[model samples]
Target: MALKYVEEYRDGTLARDLVKKIHSVSKKKLRLMEVCGTHTTSIFRHGIRSVLPKGITLLSGPGCPVCVTAQKDIDAFVAFARVKNVIVTTFGDLMKVPGSSSSLTKEKACGADVRIVYSVFDAVNIARENKDKEVVFCGVGFETTIPTIAAGILMGIEGKLDNFSIYSANKLTPPALAALMETDGVQIDGFILPGHVSVITGTDAYRGTFEKYDIPSVIAGFEPIDILQAILLLIQQNEAGKPALENAYPRAVSHAGNVKAKQIMNQVFEVCNASWRGIGQIPSSGMELKKEYQRFDAAIKFAMDMPDVPEPKGCACGQILMGLKTPEECVLYKKKCTPMNPVGPCMVSSEGSCAAFYRYS
Candidate 1:
């Protein structure tokens, strides 16, 4: 029965029917952007682009957390790794991401105590075990992860783990969407919003951006059927000359989203201006620890102020993230950059659009 439920969404017949509907209705030259890295991976993995009409072009957005992490933030994480008696814990995807001068992977090779952790709780546990050493978790994510990081901080407080801190490069999704709409030369007819983020923020999180831009948006799950249905919806909305914020992944997402998770997140963090790897600073697009939780902030605790640096020359990661260029269009994509050796964060992250394009395209 479980197998049946999973297979139904991947059913070839159902997918084919949806593809046919998309091709039939997609008459205009609509350039839709998928605002989640998972959606980009699912689209490429399932060959959703190949099935869709040529008129409907799907562009990847600044959705991957690691991909969009500012260069200075990466530098800060690297700097943290170099500090004396400091153990830098981060998600595995961030290991190879090049900072201004170094990366955690390189620092680890040079005897820096850099550890890859699956969860923020794991980092907290590491701090608990090594009370003598300072454990700084590289906090990089969206609404989907902020709550867990918040919970981990609360755990630290309960245990009185003074050795633990988090360098939050956390970003919010809605403001970034608005920034994209305001940027010149960015042509997006609709948005295929992130499913995982929507599960936490609910459909209501996007209402402000939706109302401001009045762009056709749909929250979609990371499945072939889900993506195809989202594409069809976007095409339908464009063809009808009507724009609406719709939730196609209603199974996991709701109007209010996960209230408890949001409340927990709000308890620990507050909004701030956050910089993006490719995109510049967007107002109130970042989350930092609150004044009461300032003790848990690695940036404030260490007084590490990393300067804004230029990205690697000839790397179109910023342009690519903004949907101005595809991976193939980048000069360093297959030549100077590969998954084995990434010049930019976009190629290093698992859900990165460049990685997806390289793996599948």
Candidate 2:
């Protein structure tokens, strides 16, 4: 069979050439961080780390939505499960994230009526079917998934599904990048920016961050070639002492991004301060339902209030997310916290650095 478009990008010869170029140009001890969980997994899956030069180190950032979700938010999801006549719906990754005292899976096992939903619309459909039951969807993701949730809210409004609501833990990318730069011990030479999030936010969304920090950054696709290409670009920039933000995946991304999707998002939601698991609250980094859309706000409807909780002791998820440590450096990594019994959100979520390390490394 002829090679498909995607398969062509994964070609062995092309990848090797990029790797050789990366080794050649990479002379400085560069700490390049792939600021997307998907990129983290992809790098590990393709053994990109193994092929890289000894001086070049790749770090994982606060890119995994589930991994970065605050402890209080997880507690809120569990709290939703405890509400009477409430059907708590969420993405599959959230099922195992350990909240302060309990997880959604534990709540469901204790009969809290938690359901795994693939989309926000699925939760809306459930709410429509069970008119008497309050359906709360745990909305957690980045720009790629937030607009769809907004569209689902619009759908719920059209269908008059008053029982349907969402607890939005949706986050923004650029703000988090700025937060990373400000972090005390966090050291990153460059960033392998998220491709999917960049598709919606466009390259322009990061221009402010890039211009302010002057870090060599590149938006890359999930494929090995794309990542290698991005690494090569970052290396080239660093070697030449020229920092820039470039788009390696221009086929799917542009300078302005998806305007219609952003418009839909802005219409339904507004910016708010959001807490990251390891990283503390970053201002204007979260999305919450606007006043006009508060009817769909699950936290308000259920009167849910969860106090913040500290992460597990010796669980280096926070440090790992900040690119300060790797999974191997964590005390509880494979010894105490396997995926079967995850001590941290990083182990629970598939895109998490720990989970990616466990699976691919």
Candidate 3:
């Protein structure tokens, strides 16, 4: 069959067949976690929860870029936006993530210039259009999105776009995944590894997760079939008392990953201590623009101070992000922390567990 865009991946009949197989193979109660924001959104978008058997439980994790983004960073973005001749451009989800006592949305209402972007390229274009304004892009996402961000930087450099900059908050996947697994919080029987992220980082990057913890890790696609098949593979592993790494999305992901992109990443950034809103500080999970590209580093350009921002009083976003609690567990999730007036980032970002739960649950 020929490949297309969205429809090529989302095969509904195949998904149903796989779901039936998952039900047949899964004997014991299998609690699986999908550690990708895209997967979370797909699960909700496709009504995946309703189709699943009662014996299987799917949990959310710290996968969403906006959800995992530390409040201090959002504050820093707000700070930059407030500066004269600076316009903050970011993905829509970031506008509402609470920072200090306020958010970018609140700041926008109070007249701190903030604009939404579909991609880093869009932000760059906006900078060119508004040459007098210092357009600082709020760079947030996992490996899947970082390549484009890096490409944008090179484009900026090539074009000599002096008005453009990036407040990079890009994070690594395996390190954060390991941190979640290390704690005695959630009992994740197996992991439906993020397929998009796996395409960039590869199956080799996650070999340690399987080897270290005897955890079955399967790189899964966003399609319902892919998710069900991954669960079946995991269940088979668990039943046989064997833990291993598998890739269900081989069409996109290879064992080795994208070498050229990794090279660009290595050249541009280095590992550093990263703060996840709920997951706390995971060592060497974040990327900082290297000294060679210090001129492009927004943090250095603006002299941004990352203060310890507190989570909202009644919000359980932290607990939700850890998979220790659901969005429903949070008193503020649907009430105070909603998409319209999101008290937390999770509720704002569609990929975020809270947003998924709020939208479909």
Candidate 4:
């Protein structure tokens, strides 16, 4: 049964069949945006881009959480590292992301208390162990990771760990998708939706946006067959002149997502205006600690006031995220902005389109 399951999804025969079907149905040139960082990585890892027809252009949207996090938020994290007796904790990817002036790694090298944590609960534990020091977690993610962060706050509160707080830069996936639709000069025929985010927000969360824009969207898993199937579905919809939102990854996603997780996220955080690294501020796209949960807000606790710093000059990360430009088109790409020294967040993040392109292409 296990062998059948793996072969069913990853079988060469199935993937080739889907690709042939896609090529047969696809007559018109179409632009499809994959709105998840992991999808971008998977597509590259599986060499899906090379197999696709030249008529079908796949663009990577604002999928990387670390890539989309605004420069101001990075600065705030760096600010925490500079504070005396304060422990700044964040995911490993965030440690290399440069702020307006410096990065967490640089701060740590300068004798600051910066730590890389795998989870928010680990930061909470650090706070619990060191009562004399303040532990601030740099929270940067989308719907897929927000619920766990919310639960960690509740855990801290229950344990009476007052020293723990979070500088939330969490973004909502549906809102970003809506924002992309409204962007000028952006043309997307279909949306290859994210599987993980859909598992949290569900197919219903994308209904309003799909109804408004009337774009064909398919929530797909990470497997090669799964992506190829989604592409075939998108081609069929475009050929029939029908635009609808559908879930291709039914085994993992549903109409109604994890209800308890949503409740916990709502209990701890509220919607606010959020700044995207290259896309600017999208209203009600960011998550912040609620009024009752203000005690756990790291920005509030540290009195952090980050400056409105602009992105790196000549970096086309914003345009790349919006599908207006590809990473190869960027002047900084491969010249000055390699993975070792990324000029923009797109190169720094593992899920970033630029990073995938560099690795695969």
TM-score for all predictions? Answer: 0.98, 0.97, 0.94, 0.97
Q: Is candidate 3 or candidate 4 better by TM-score?
A: 4
- Candidate 2 shows a clash count of 0
| Candidate 1 weakest ten by summed lDDT | 1-10
Instruction: Pick out the ten consecutive residues of candidate 2 with the lowest summed lDDT.
Output: 1-10
The lDDT of each candidate is 0.93, 0.93, 0.84, 0.92
**Model 3: per-residue Cα lDDT at residue 51:** 79
- Candidate order (TM-score): 1, 2, 4, 3
lDDT of 1 at 248: 97
**Candidate 2 to truth, TM:** 0.97
Clashing residue pairs, candidate 3? none
Task: Judging by lDDT, tell me the better candidate of 2 and 3.
Answer: 2
Clashes of 1: 0
lDDT of 4: 0.92
**Candidate 1 per-residue lDDT over residues 237-272, each given as its tens digit:** 999999999999998999999999999999999999
